[model samples]
Target: MPALCWNQRRRDFYAITTDVSTEGIRFRSSSRLSPGEDLTCSIRHIGLLEARIDRAVGEEFTVSVRGGRSALTDLARQFVALSRAQDLRPEVVRVHHRIVPKQKIVQVTLDGGLGVSGHVLNISASGVALLVEQSLEIGATIQVGRKLARVMRHFTHGVGAAFLEPFEPSAVHEAMTL
Candidate 1:
């Protein structure tokens, strides 16, 4: 399951759980974390879980679960639900979503004050992909034009952002026009 893990000393960054159980969870992180460190992980829809780093081997680490059994049970249920949902989800639905290409220059500013100029590669009601030079950390909220967006994924040229709220399709096109 997709997750975000960050120790109190750092900002939230992206991670994916390799495995999870009542006693512990194993996951891979983009950032290096030290053993014995306590961290909070916000799993999608599963809320936050307190954890202590058990060990680190390169990017993969195990964290001892600090939350109660109820939380662990809920987390396990969420994982199973998400897995089933994925199995039931259609794989080709994105083909019908229109992608409008435009080259308007825009400013992308992260919540932590990192800013970069980027070219809008395409715009849709769901999100916009930008061709940017600076590397952006996934899961960070960024300002795109007037709308707040979350960095969802990265590509060779840049990053993609999903808007905080869905916009009217035409409204997105109008806003992206320069």
Candidate 2:
């Protein structure tokens, strides 16, 4: 196992579990990030700091920072550490379903013709994530229950998708309630 250094002070852990890659990640007073703004982040692992902006989705952005190690490295280290720690002690929590949700599982072939299987990690009125058996190209097109999903980006265990046809919000909500 490798060692990772992170801060114990900052509470911004959203970047940790998320698979979204940003050219830059910044902490600002506002609740949003603009496309062109430089992002500065304080990472909790490996005492690394990074400065970057979105150069391109699913690609490396321009990185320049004065202090700490590589932001990407620090983040990667934290991920490894967190994953190992979670494995040691297991915890599970369940929330009762108010409505029985409807879901469909499917396997998709990459645009390059590589076949992979991913479970529907989640689905809502908006979209779903196919927790694929293998990684696919970032811009790959996927077939989901006759619908198409253009790969926006890859998450830790799967890829994210913006549904070509959004599901009905009420139906999703009702399904969750069941």
- Which candidate wins on lDDT? 1
- As a whole number from 0 to 100, the lDDT of residue 138 in candidate 1 is 98
Q: TM-score of model 1 relative to the true fold?
A: 0.45
Q: Cα lDDT for residue 52, model 2?
A: 42
Q: Which sections of candidate 2 miss by over 4 Å?
A: 1-104, 112-115, 173-178
Q: What TM-score, computed on C-alpha atoms, does each candidate reach?
A: 0.45, 0.37
Name the 10 consecutive residues with the lowest summed lDDT in model 1. Answer: 92-101
Per-residue error for 127 in candidate 2, Å, reads 1.6
Q: Which candidate tops TM-score? A: 1
Q: Which residue runs does candidate 1 get wrong by more than 4 Å?
A: 88-178
Error of 2 at 143 (Å): 0.9
Model 1 residue 166 lDDT score: 67
What is the TM-score (0 to 1) of candidate 2?
0.37
**What tens-digit string does per-residue lDDT give for candidate 2 at 1-178?**
1212123333333233234223323232212333344444544444445444333333222334444346555555566777687677645232222222354456575666655555776665555666776767777677665556778777787887766676556656533421
lDDT of 2: 0.50
